[model samples]
Target: MKYPTFEDVKKARETLKDVSTSHWVQDDLFTWKWWLLLAATFLPWVIWIKYRDKERTLEILCYGLLWAILASATDVIGGESLLWGYPDKLLPMVPPLFPADISVIPVSYMFIYQYTNTLKRYLVFSLLLSGFFSYIVEPIFIKLEMFALHNWAHTYSFIGFFILSLIPYYLIKKLTIKK
Candidate 1:
């Protein structure tokens, strides 16, 4: 089969403009609501990173980056599916994908990983943390228009995020053990 030409791809992208325009709005135009949500989402990460061990700071940063990507991917998919949404006012004038929600989640996970020593204990704690965040913090976000759940209402089902977090933790532990 012949590949589509650049012109054809350009036309297709233009056609998709309406679907993507909301993501391109000016960032500095944020409202008070946006600032409040941003503070709540980002402050904890800043405080935790400040107190983190110097030697392990790089490790935590790396893990934070990885989990940020994971969370971004999930957020994108969820946004496309109408399972959730973020207000355009909440994002800064940067990469369209750079939202506060994505930035915060991985750092939170890194904090959990750093504070706990054992996999079993970390897993349990992480699950509880995920449940609390999902049930409590997320609903407030929902109210603030940072996100919107579609067919599925948010619940304390830490199983999914726990499993997602477990994979990296397990791999990290195994590699550290081997070394």
Candidate 2:
């Protein structure tokens, strides 16, 4: 019931760091999952860059950046709360699923935003995309042992992703200059 001293906290942190390093070396590094994560980290950005609307590049990028920030923050909260976690990491450090949070999610959402010119289309795409992520994508990650859900369910993810998509869309809609 007593608060731990800073020294104790440091010791715990060091222990975790050592364990993460060892686990990465023995189980995570150079594995097929790691290679897949590497590809996932870069490939979407490449495709997004090539196919994105050239005229609205900056506006679209702003939307993507907002999504990245929100996704990364939510990932951290989920991991910290033991709602979900990543088993295979590209690195031994924290924010284990950088590819999904920083690259894939944002880039994919950005495409949806750029392509959907109307609110109705955006909502429909958002709902479908959220379902795809929560049901199909998450199940695959669970099967692959890349992601684990301790106290969360696909329905929660579905709702969360759908709302996350709409937030950026609506905000960007207001922020973008009228033409």
Per-residue C-alpha lDDT of model 1 across residues 74-144, encoded as one tens digit per residue: 66676667666565545443333354445666767888888898878897888887887678877877776
RMSD to truth, every model:
4.1, 1.1
- List, residue by residue over 63-167, the lDDT tens digit for candidate 2: 999999999999999998999988889989858988999899999999999998899998999999999999999999999999999999999999999999988
Model 1: how far is 128 from its true place, Å?
1.1
Quote each prediction's TM-score: 0.74, 0.97
lDDT of 1: 0.66
Per-candidate count of clashing residue pairs (backbone under 3 Å):
0, 0
Off by over 4 Å in 1: 1-28, 37-42, 92-97
Give the lowest summed-lDDT range of ten residues in model 1.
92-101
Q: What is the TM-score of candidate 1? A: 0.74
lDDT of 2: 0.94
- What stretches of model 2 exceed 4 Å from their correct place? none
